[model samples]
Target chain A: MKTLVIVAHPQLADSGTQQFLKTSLQNFSTVTWHVLAPDVDVAAEQALLRRHDRIIFQFPLYWYSAPALLKHWEDEVLTRNFVYGAQHELAHKELGIVVTTGDAKREFVAGGKEDYTMSELLRPYQALAHKAQMSYLPPLPIFQFAYLTDAQKQALLVTYQQYITNSDFTSFHGQELWFEGQLKAKIDQTKGTSKQQLTQILTAVQDNREQLEELRWTLSLIKDNEDE
Target chain B: MKTLVIVAHPQLADSGTQQFLKTSLQNFSTVTWHVLAPDVDVAAEQALLRRHDRIIFQFPLYWYSAPALLKHWEDEVLTRNFVYGAQHELAHKELGIVVTTGDAKREFVAGGKEDYTMSELLRPYQALAHKAQMSYLPPLPIFQFAYLTDAQKQALLVTYQQYITNSDFTSFHGQELWFEGQLKAKIDQTKGTSKQQLTQILTAVQDNREQLEELRWTLSLIKDNEDE
Candidate 1:
């Protein structure tokens, strides 16, 4: 599937984790990286979105949420007739988020300083996904990136690379596995795990991974193709 | 104090309750109603915000949260160094929300379709307020605006007028009273209530109705002055 990664960091050039992830996607040929600002031309954005099957919003968690420009993009780009109401254009697209958090994951819970789970904090986006009729993937969270040891950061970078490129739902090595487990449990319970069903599930997962990798590769080629 | 109302309605002209509230504010002299949108210029927005002591975000609740644009404004206007970090511009300013909900207040709870309280859904804003060192008031939620009788809406208009003008904090009536009661209980227990304090509380409650009316008048005048 074609993927559009909308990088929404206010100062992406200064970002280590986001910069690293953006650089790593250079090897992939299917993903289309769109570094968006609030002032992006609407027609231009629509064209970029039309080429992608999945739209991934990547940002650093600011005040427990996304930066303002991304919010502006959603407001302006995801217009009424296009994103909601009866004839929404974004109905077929898949929506996901890749966020780097300054705080640890444990700090985003009931008794924690943040006092809300990441899921609960990000529920607004989930609600938006539901309204837009898009399949919402669980967020890819990189917690405490600033404090990570060099080795830990390297490990995180590798995991993040694997996550963005891997389409196989079952083999996702990053934090996305938490969401995958939730999805697996639901599917397993609903379908009743017969041997044939299990095989199909595994195959679908692998296929999804390959599609994701292709998307990454495609995105890297967009700039080169435009130059030519 | 000059109060700024940042109104965020996808279609403000089409909304009945919101339109009425917007109309009522015309009677006040100290209120600045800022109808926010993507088209609004950034420098102009910053200037408007700098002029106001109290910033109130008014919006119809969408899927148990603010619309995308409102979130965008929060992200954009409330910047790191300005709103937080070393230099705090909005420090000491009062931040409030005036939200209109389609569902009843009871429906935003543990067993409801939302499975979360309005307070929980709005935690991100509250967190923003805390981080920015602004006094975060409990949101003024107009539950089931469509279901309200004309008389109820009229009364609400009056109460909302008081809320926006920062007149008597306790005069406006709604389920917010219950929320305030809960807050009061916490406050009462912490500081033993002296007779003078009790008198002050009683006077504040008694003055609410008139204070709200006076506030509306004050805000309307402010709007008129700005228009000229």
Candidate 2:
């Protein structure tokens, strides 16, 4: 699926998180990155949005929200008759937010220092998506980016790519399926033992995914029976 | 208390609600109204915020959020050493939002057309207030301005004034006190049965306020006892 990443950091050149994400996302040929600048052409931005299947609003959280330019882009680009209203252009398309924060992830909980969950604070975007008749994806929140180790950063890069490209990637089961598919595609090009190991790993992942799905179904049945 | 209202509507000139609010708020000598313009001076805006005892961010809700210029104001004016950081300048000051919406008030309830309460959707501003150590006042949501009757518009004008000026206007007792005070001031200027009628109305309002407070206290006591 074609994905669009609209980056909206005022000081993108100076931000380490923006730099990391930019470099990480550059490998995907189906992904297009648009930076929010002062002289952005509204028509071109709307056209770009129409062309993409999944649109990710990537920004650093400023005062528990996105920076100014993103808001500006929303105001200018998402016009009434064009993007919203009776004849909607962005219907069924996915809208996601990838936010980086200076504070720790633990700080974004009910009784934490922030006093509200990230989901609660980011409800406006969800509401916006609802209004536009788009599918609202769960936001990807990266906290304390400056303190992330090399391994953690590399893992985040892979996760970020999955967030953009993977269609059914809202669950661990879906992620495992993607990983298994990736291994299967490469297994044909490998040697005897390597191919065998890859096949074994894929089988293990599939078994784990089935177990998770079964457990989830059992839990839902229990909940339903209790309600009845 | 001196109030500083920072108005941030992109098309303020065309907005009827904004115009009504502007005209209504003009009568208050202690209130200063500042409209956000394109080339806003950062230092001046910060200084303005510092001078006021109560700060109200007034705007029409654009895409379930504030207009872009308000976000720009926050980004530029609220600096590290000034608005936030160790020596935060905005601490203990009242930060209120006076937002106008195109949707109906009933639409902003659980299971309603909007599918979320106004308080839930406007959590970002609350979080911003928490981060700045400012007193987060309950937001005033004026909905469906175009559909409001003349009397409704007049009531909203009085409510808008109270939101900006009254320190404890959220409670019924505070509103009754304000109404009583206003009536008391006008009593000496009148004579005969007109004065008596006003006196009777004030007494009735005060009595209702007292009864409401007592009922609230009783309900809390019952809840506390049940918890015990």
**Per-candidate TM-score against the hidden true structure:** 0.63, 0.84
| lDDT per residue as tens, model 1, B1-228 | 789999998888889887788788885678988888766566678778788888898898865567767876766676677776678888888889898877778867776655567777787887777777788887888898889898998888767876776434663455345334534654555555564576576557647745876888999999999999
* Fnat per candidate: 0.46, 0.83
lDDT of 1 by residue, A1-228 (tens): 678899998888899888778887785577888887658687778778877778888998877777766776776677667676557777878888898987888888777766677877787777677667788877888888778898987777666655565554434444354344434654565644574576576668767766887887898899779999
Error of 2 at A102 (Å): 0.9
Listed models, DockQ each: 0.27, 0.64
Best by TM-score: 2
Where does candidate 2 chain A have its weakest 10-residue lDDT segment? A180-189
Q: Give the alpha carbon lDDT tens digit for every residue of A1-228 in model 2.
A: 899999998999999888888887775678998888977798898899899999999998887789988998998889888766767989999999999988899989987889898899999999888878899999999999889999999899889878987887878777887777667777877889988998898788789888988999999999999999
Interface RMSD of each: 3.1, 0.9
